[model samples]
Target: MTTTFADLTTMRVGGPIGRLYVPTTIPEAVDLLQRVAATADPLLVMGGGSNLVVGDVGWDGTVIKMATSEFDIDGELLTAAAGVEWDRVVAAAVDAGLAGLEALSGIPGLVGGTPVQNVGAFGTVTSDVLHSLSVYDRQTGQVERWTPDRCGFGSHRQSVFKHSDRWVVLEVTYRLRRGGQSGPIEYAELASRLGIAPGGTAAPSDVREAVLALRRGRAMVLDPDDHDTWSVGSFFINPVLPEVPDSARGCPRYPDVKGVKLTAAWLIERAGFPRGYGTEWGDGTVALSSRHTLAVTNRGGATTSEIMKFAAHIRAGVEARFGIRLNPECDLVNCSF
Candidate 1:
């Protein structure tokens, strides 16, 4: 009766875990990490498990579950423990008449995971409002505070914390506006939904509501009863290229500091792997989310192997059709397709 990763992760598909530890305090988490680091076994520090896909072979070492959930608000400055649910932070900020976080509402995962992925939605990202963060640097066995510049924030979900185990985010501080209005709405879809022009502003509460509704419509929000939400919100990162290739003519493109960012969903659908494409592949256990082409869902009783297999098919198909390889946005644990 060992607990498996299926019980912990949103995807609900990984194999049995060897060991698990839930640290209720930052000090306790650091002590556990030190102990684990002394051993030869592998280590995984998990938050909400919303962005992970583990192999069927399972983890053979230690898994640290961040469980601390304390937060403080000093006027317009909000600081939250790494384990706090991300949506709760947004809701609290809006209730306090603070702006900046409203546009990022409804994103699943913990506060600590936000910096790791630079989580964003609507028209805002975590780095946009981040002031500083406290981290337990395992390499030095010391706690340190780092500014946004030190975090190496980049385009399309890039951050220094991603795919690295050297730092454990303990708390994050966000500087928000005192006024009740949100930042300028730069995303066209969100502006249209709010009945405003792009770059216009709205009440933080209204923006939060609109964001949550949009996420729910796409099955991006977690709902236990909905198979479509039983997956990471997006399986692939939108490829950023120097120039739009001829094969991707007419595909939606956006400007990025590095180059141009192409829509992953557009490439996926055009490659013939439309929404709900894998229903006929393997006993119907896994498929693209019916509401979103970018989400690969566990329909019911799907294995991690099945999920990876389906994802590989989509990646391969897209590459074959467009000569561009799509990379996974989710962190693959002890697994690769």
Candidate 2:
């Protein structure tokens, strides 16, 4: 029986798929992908099913869900199947005294999905610790081990799975540090909350605790009871635009590949889209999160169309004011404006 796409995504909104295969093993998953690719029928590879927004009309193709959620650690390295939850991996790493991922404690979604978007939080991004991956290259129908360089990880992005959907992340290997602490706290707000200097280190578990607490405060942590967490996490990646000097641009900038990443939240706020925008009495079907401007939440019964309209309003408003276009972080399917 096919599972409705709504049952699989965090958004809990989508139509039905022609077929949905929950493969329990890597081989089965690979074979299914190969067969689908050979047929040239459209297919989607899903993980914990976070970070997706499928239209109400649903998908017309097959969806292969990776359900191989095994995770293990040998020495300081960690290996996890694509289906493993990403935040749970962080918790495990912290409990094991592994340091590198502590600051990324509350990120949602699956392990395999981490590399897909270079999932990150606080000051820690996944690319910082990823060492290798076992991937099925759909282009050649071959399974191979790939290094971080081959993955083309970037600011909230990676080449391994972006745009092409040509690789099914079977397993991922992370080179985590042992018995040390989190990498330097690069986020000023986090450091201030922890009472440490910027770029300072904290005990791995402490960092995890602090990060989780901070996330909870911001309503970034997933809590089914909280409608704020019902939406995709951070709807937009901070827009990294061409570097204009502070003198030339008249605002702040953070380092990035081409230039600097401007916080989309900052731009949205500056552009006059405040938190809880478009809501009446602070309650609307589709609302900007009260705690964070970057997140668009479903107040209740909000459809993909409503969310898209709100998002489009914000995008146009921001672009008109800041002269920079914002790109959505979630995989927007079947809706175009």
Q: What TM-score quantifies how close candidate 1 is to the native fold?
A: 0.97
Could you tell me how far off, in angstroms, the CA of residue 163 lies in candidate 2 after the best superposition?
Answer: 1.5
Give per-model TM-scores. Answer: 0.97, 0.93
List candidate 1 stretches off by more than 4 Å: none
lDDT of 1 by residue, 228-261 (tens): 9999889899999999999998889988878999
Highest TM-score scorer: 1
- Model 1: lDDT to the true structure: 0.91
Cα displacement (Å) at residue 223, model 1: 0.2
In model 2, which regions exceed 4 Å deviation?
155-158, 245-250, 281-283
lDDT of each: 0.91, 0.81
What tens digits encode model 2's per-residue C-alpha lDDT throughout 168-206?
899999999889767889799888888899999889888
